[model samples]
Target chain A: MSAMTHEEVRELLAAHVMELLLPEERASVVAHLAGCAECAREVESLRATSAELALAAPDRSFDARRCNGVRSRLLARTAADRDARARLAAGQLPEREPLSLRPPHATAPESAGGWRTASMVLAASVAGLILFGGSILVQSRRELAQARESESQRQRLIAGLIGPGVRLIELAPTERRPGSARMFWNQTLGAWTFLAYDLAIPAEGRTYQIWLITPDDRRISAGIFTPSADGNAIATTTYALAADSLTAVAVTEEPAGGVDAPSGDIVLLGAAR
Target chain B: MIADVRSPDDADALVTRVAGGDEHALGVLYDRWSPLVFSVCVHILGDDDEAEEAVEETFWQAWRQAERYDVTRGAVATWLTTIARSRALDRLRASRRRQEETMSHLSETKRAAVDATTRRGDDPARSAEVAERRVLVRQALLALPLEQREVLELAYFRGLSQTEIAEHTGQPLGTVKTRVRLAMEKLRDRLGILRERDA
Candidate 1:
């Protein structure tokens, strides 16, 4: 390609940083940057400015539960990849039981070779058996640990509800809705236990989201939950903020996964006392 | 584990660990940056499901390409946001293609209704430094002339080429290019502190 003039290259730098240049123009800009110091510096600075545009987008409140699910899946996939690489490096095939360890009801292939093959198959079976037993023990231990963690979480929640420094905030239904709720905010523990009753079931593909309004009127997502068929729901979450900074609490009906901001009508409202 | 306080150095260290196959470091990075990434995706895609999918793809790409990250190019947050915007735009373009083929009859009003479903709210839970930076960036964007800001928004968020933006806005191609250049330079000037800090 013929060399573009300095003026032409500089004009395209902004568009290039925004990824808005046509393919040919982008190629020309890339080529020019390789040979032009000034254009390269300008492009880098413009690119950094372009990136800051992302901050202009409003924050969307993601469902914490859903976020956790995504993180878990990501970690699992990475772990699986790591294990496969390790196994490959160690000269082992992917995880699978030896044929000799198949259930007794399954048919076994006839011995196709002599004592060497037989000895290897025997050794494989023994190794598979040991691995299977080890996995079972590990699984049991993991389950026990999980159970203990769950119990401990429950204990913490109970303590937060009944412990000293817990303040009760009574939520009254707005004129447009029919529900009453209460919040047990333990500022010292940074725990919140919310319980609502007589709330109408949200429309299909909708759920109730709780928001903590700061004194400055900034709304922060506490959590999202759906009421039971009998018009009752409970949710617990932890947030760390100065007690005096919170001014009010409100609930709104939002899309199934909830929204980053309150766009729906307020269903219940309460002032932090 | 997610730390209560994070600096640019900490973020760089996290990326290095991620490059070395540290899953915990990856998790901390995800926790620290996913909200901003998700927000960008939602702004571009305007659909939660697609945006969520884009977030997953962005971080997964980050995980696979961690070793290629260049701190000299920009900060970690900026790098992640760049990846996020690219992923979201890819999804947006693909979905538009599908819509053109299967839902050609869909009216512009109906399409707009879908976009309207995305709501906006501040995440006060974010670090004070991030929130302050957000305020500063927003102020700079708002201070731009309407025409200049319009061109930048169309190109950045809507992923429109200069020629396409000219067509969309019924302006001349040269005018569109000029507007983009002016807007970016002004933004660079207004957000100079960010540039210095990233340096």
Candidate 2:
């Protein structure tokens, strides 16, 4: 880019302070500010002006007195994030408790009736075990092996959620189901996790599938899922694509094995907030 | 962890610890700053739930970008409030777009209300209420010429670029830039005078 004139640079100073400048313009301003003491002082003055302007906004002194759960959520998320990053640095996947350890109601729909939901949950678990366990060496070790794999995948996702530079985008339910999904993604790593909560169980032959719609409108599968009896499913995967390339994520009802495209109802949808 | 963060330096130290993965430091930072952050978000987005989301995301963004923070630019509160404002504006854009898209599905009166809300850049009744609550910012902004105030609001609250503001207002790019510069300069002058007078 051509060097900006003093007059042109002056125009950009305030916008630069507000971070409204385009990337190239920002770089040019930063470059100019380095050598120009006069411009730097101007930047500082504008920054102070911005600061005062910001602090002058309405103050919720009374609201701050109440200890809402904001800090706890921040700490839980921060611990999760820091653990994920430490595990990555250590060259070991983060440790995660198996989803099976969670109570059935925590992972499945309570509205489905107690005993019926329990049976359905057990049946779903067995089917998943058989499908994934069939590849194992011994049939006797199927459950153990499946549990171990689930634990490992769970750890990987936990790490991804609190991973370095992660953005946790909460997907709202578009339908009547009382469930939601929160996605955590690190743009640099392209690692993402979709944490689906309290979703309704799919029919016997149907499953919940996630798809990411790219900015260019290409639908990429984020993989499929089945909530345990407690109605929770955690799916973690790497996209190897820039985070900005994604426009939104949606969960659709699909066949048991999943499909290449969305052909069912979108139960939940959210943009990159 | 130290429980009392009584100064900007303490806040700076907290940020350093947060960058090092100290969750306690983050909590302290949030305790110290969330109300201001919440207020900024609420003023811009005008929805409690959305404003709360902005607060959460702003702190998380602070954590993620902690290592990149430069103390020389401004104090931690300033830096954080900047992030909060940016995130709130992002929500405002999303909310406005959603309203526009879903207007046809709403009642005629609701559509008209939504249009008025959008055109005014915020809910006027809420703005008036908030302006009463925040005298300093309101006074500072009210002191500006309408042209300058409009450009400044578009740039700061709406997150519009100079070119976009120019296009939105049907003015030349040069005019928009000049108005913005003049506005900031005027604000700086007026705010400085107010500060010295208060002192």
Best by TM-score: 1
User: For residues A1-273, what per-residue lDDT tens digits would candidate 1 score against the true structure?
Assistant: 677899999999998989888888889999989999888878877887888777677677776744654554455445544544565577553332111100112223222221110100111111111112112111232343344333223223343454346788889988966789887786554667677777898999998888887777778777777765657665666555576877888999899877777889899999997
Residue A20 Cα positional deviation in candidate 2, in Å, after optimal superposition? 3.9
How well does candidate 1 score on lDDT at residue B84? 93
lDDT at B110, model 2: 30
DockQ of each: 0.33, 0.26
The Cα local distance difference test for each model comes to 0.67, 0.63
Model 2 accuracy (lDDT, Cα): 0.63
| Local distance difference test, candidate 1 | 0.67
CA displacement after TM-score superposition, residue B86 of candidate 1 (Å): 0.9
What is the C-alpha lDDT profile of model 2 across B1-199, one tens digit per residue? 0111113477789999888878778887887678768866776665676787788788888988899887766667667878898889888888877775233422332332222213222212122322332354456666787778777766776566788778767899989878888888888776563243224
Off by over 4 Å in 1: A91-273, B1-6, B101-120, B193-199
- Native contacts retained per candidate? 0.64, 0.48
Question: Per-residue lDDT for A82-193 in model 2, tens only?
Answer: 6556655775544442221111112232222111111111222432322121121112334544555544443344445542458877788896768888777754345566
TM-score of candidate 2 restricted to chain B? 0.67
